[model samples]
Target: MGNTDIFLDKYKQLENCAINEFKLPPDGSAVAKLEKRSEFKDIKYELNYCREVRNLLQHNQKLDDEFPVEPSNKMIELLDTVIDRIKNPVRCIDVAILDRNLIWRSYEDRVLPTIKLMNEKNISHIPILKDRRVVGDFSDNCVFPFLLGDDNCHIDENTRFKDLKQYLDLEAHPSEVFKFIPADSKLSYAEKLYEEARNRHERIGLVFLTANGRSDERILGILTAWLIIGQ
Candidate 1:
């Protein structure tokens, strides 16, 4: 067949992939549904344009026994890209900093050195792990409470994460919060969570990807706004 036939075939594959991947209603407009997904936000216009082209190709009358319009190579390439994205959706774990590469500290680890490292690296948050599981997190927000809790509270060579235990709890930070998501969670879902938090005037300090999206589970990876923004 011609390029028109190939375009139609690819478009059909995209629709099917999207329907099965996103569980979109078979009777509804796939492009419309995809528009609502964060993953498709960047290509919304292209998707709509492709749909319009498909409609024209199928319904518009042919002239001189030839199709009225032909899809461009770029358009076909876009369809292929969209199809690939649908079949291999980016997961939160794909962008997250894996535990092995994560910059973290244990409760017994010296706090001063960790803080120094954070300063040098411009890291805003540090997870405190115990038994290979997240017990709490330390950040600039934790500093205020820890220091004001007592007149003698101070950070020195002897200071350890255990000393800031109370302030390090996930709930201890009033201005920011953390979320646990399963390793296989779609990146779009994580983006939605962050957007929802922004709508509520709250901030998501970090997202931890675990085996089952539970705080008590072993941490597999971590997501930050910086990481998501990069994607």
Candidate 2:
């Protein structure tokens, strides 16, 4: 068909995809519903423009048996992108730092070397695992208690993470908390978690992606505030 026909076809596909993806009422305004979702924030303006174009093509009278406006290639591409995004949303693991590339330590691992590495790499948190499962996390906050507890207690070459077991526990440090999300969780869900944490005046240091969002599950990847918010 012509450009107008092609554009209308694609736009209708987009509307159907949005309706099915979001479970919206079939008779409702699909574009308007999509605008309200945080996942569609990036393309809100484009959606609005496309909606206006659709209105013009459907409501305005045509002259000489031709529509006044036709969608460009770029518009068609944008519609394709939005439809694809709605069909297959970006998952948390898709953007997380995968486990193989993560800098982590075991409970029996030396703490001094890890601390030096953290300093060199500017790493704020490191998962403390045992048998490939996260037992706790180590961070600057985990070391503060030791420093302030007793003048004699200090970190040394032979110090192991096991020595700071109490401090490394998930609930031991309240300043920064760790959360576990399923590996297949959508990025929007992760964002919502961070937003809720912010609303509660809490800080989420790391979001570990696991099979079923449980600490007992194997860690597949990790998410940080900078990684999620910066995106």
TM, every model: 0.94, 0.93
Q: lDDT value for candidate 2?
A: 0.89
Candidate 1, residue 218: lDDT: 94
What is the clash count of model 1? 0
- Residue-level lDDT tens digits of model 2 in 113-207: 99889999999999998877999999988899867778787899999999899999999985988899899999999999998999999999899
- Model 1 worst lDDT window (10 residues): 27-36
Kindly list the per-residue Cα lDDT of model 1 for residues 122-231, writing each as its tens digit: 99999999887999999999998899888999999999889999999999997998999999999989999999999999999999999999999999999999998888
Clashes of 2: 0
- Residue 156, candidate 1: alpha-carbon lDDT: 92
**Each prediction's whole-model lDDT (CA):** 0.91, 0.89
Q: Evaluated with lDDT, which candidate comes out highest?
A: 1
Worst 10 residues of 2 by lDDT: 145-154
